[model samples]
Target: MKRLRISLTAQIFLGLILGAAFGCFFPDFGSQLKPLGDAFIRMIKMIVVPLIFSTLVIGIAGTGDFKKLGRLGGKAIIWFEVASALALIVGLVVVNVLQPGVGVSLPAIGAAAGANAAATAQSFSISMHLLNIIPANIVEACVKSDMLQIIFFTCFFGVALAHIGEKGKIVVECCRGIAEAMFKVTHIQMNICCAKLFENYK
Candidate 1:
């Protein structure tokens, strides 16, 4: 009973109820808590990009089987497409039903909009997007935290490491270690965030 009372899920449910009550009764106090939420979001963003990059590299290099990799990649692509489609459909249905932004108004596009469009026009091109997967400056990609470019570069890097056999084990092991470390960091941060949230609710 004590374990159940102290469990994370129980804490979360209690927090949710208390938070809702507080928000209902003290809107101003609730508004003042926004910084805590923002801090949590920042912590999450800090961990996620590195985690994604390291995990992708580890996954590709560790597998070491081209045929298996290809098969799995094909299945992943299909699942991604299906999941994306389903999300779009559900989002459309919910938006139609709720009409959350029905009364919102926006200014008409101006000359600044055209300039913005021109600057980003090439990014929308399929060929350009594909080309951009191969980063001209890997350091720049990592600094900018460009996830797609990082993933693309890592996949090729991992494949090359796999192809090199015993000699490449050192690099692969390093990446795997990094991935595991990042996962632990992320887990710890998430638990900290949850604890803070639970305290705030109290």
Candidate 2:
């Protein structure tokens, strides 16, 4: 008889099903497993900034042509905005159509917290958002995982390296190496997340 080997996707699917079942049948016990999920989320978040910075730096530096890089950046921004707008429209349409909260009755837990959040959101301005794109301190940006600031810094660094011509090849090579290392680390973190998910099932 041949033994069955479950693929990672299948394992993930199975884990989701089992998790749902557990949550439905043993709400208290399932809630206690929140820490496992939180840990996995934190680890995954830790991978994003460094991985994105390294890859973006390598991509821009390797392009070698300033005009081509500018065109690429323009296309990327346009695509991102268009895609985001479409996604938001779809979500709004579905939510309006389904009215998911229509039948739900929940208690308001924190009136003060809600008011503070509303005030903060209302005070948010485009100028503030633009200012945030420029990192005051890069180390602080990385620690906070401010993706836009990190991306801005990385793109500038990459452009500077590209402009330096052959003199910058050594730094470009270093960025490429860092990117490869980050990729491996991301893969390992993903595997660890899956392991933690499976452990929660037990």
Candidate 3:
């Protein structure tokens, strides 16, 4: 059993084959499996915010140097921007070369529909994108599950904790403990979930 569990690649291959077979024979029932996939994604997202916030708070408070943090953040931002630009350029080049849209005939849109699409695209500006990063309200941001806003708030709060000096140490330690506990809980849940998923498939 342990050896079989360790062979994850083979297990995955077997699962795909079995899943395909079931879907082929029972198309109607197979469609219901989509909820499982969606639920798993939601579970991951639910854990991510708290895990990120706690970890960031602990790290920033422990760093003891705001200057170093600023330098590191600058480097990270530069790297991220460069990577995003390169990805965008590559995608544009690929799309242009492939011209996948050339032969595809989309359904004829009415003038109003076409105008709406153009208006929607026009409304999406770089300045609005940047401004959205700053949360109007933290709770509202969390309720909306805006990842960038959550990250911004975490970093801002972490820096504030760092600036508190000695008083922040206790809070930092508490956050570190909470982070560790949450990670352990997540790990256990993941292991149980994976085991159950594999067992169900088998």
Q: What stretches of model 1 exceed 4 Å from their correct place?
A: 9-26, 114-124, 196-202
Candidate 3 wrong stretches, greater than 4 Å: 1-29, 78-106, 196-202
TM-score, cand. 1: 0.81
lDDT string, candidate 3, 20-127, tens digits: 987899888878887875776677777777788788898777788888877877998899999999999999999999977787788899999999999999899999
TM-score of each: 0.81, 0.78, 0.69
RMSD to the true structure for each prediction, in A, is 4.0, 4.6, 4.8
- Best prediction by TM-score: 1
RMSD of 3: 4.8
Looking at candidate 3, what is the lDDT of residue 82?
A: 100
Q: What is candidate 2's lDDT per residue for 1-202, written digit by digit as tens? A: 4544655677677778888998999999999999997887888787788788878877898899888988998999999999999999999999999888897889886999899999999999999989879999999999998888899999899889888999888988887888888878867766665644333221
Clashes of each: 0, 0, 0
The lDDT of each candidate is 0.79, 0.84, 0.80
Model number with the top lDDT: 2
Please give the lDDT score for candidate 2: 0.84
Worst 10 residues of 2 by lDDT: 193-202
Report the C-alpha displacement of residue 195, candidate 2, in angstroms: 5.0
- The local lDDT score (0 to 100) that residue 56 gets in candidate 2 is 88
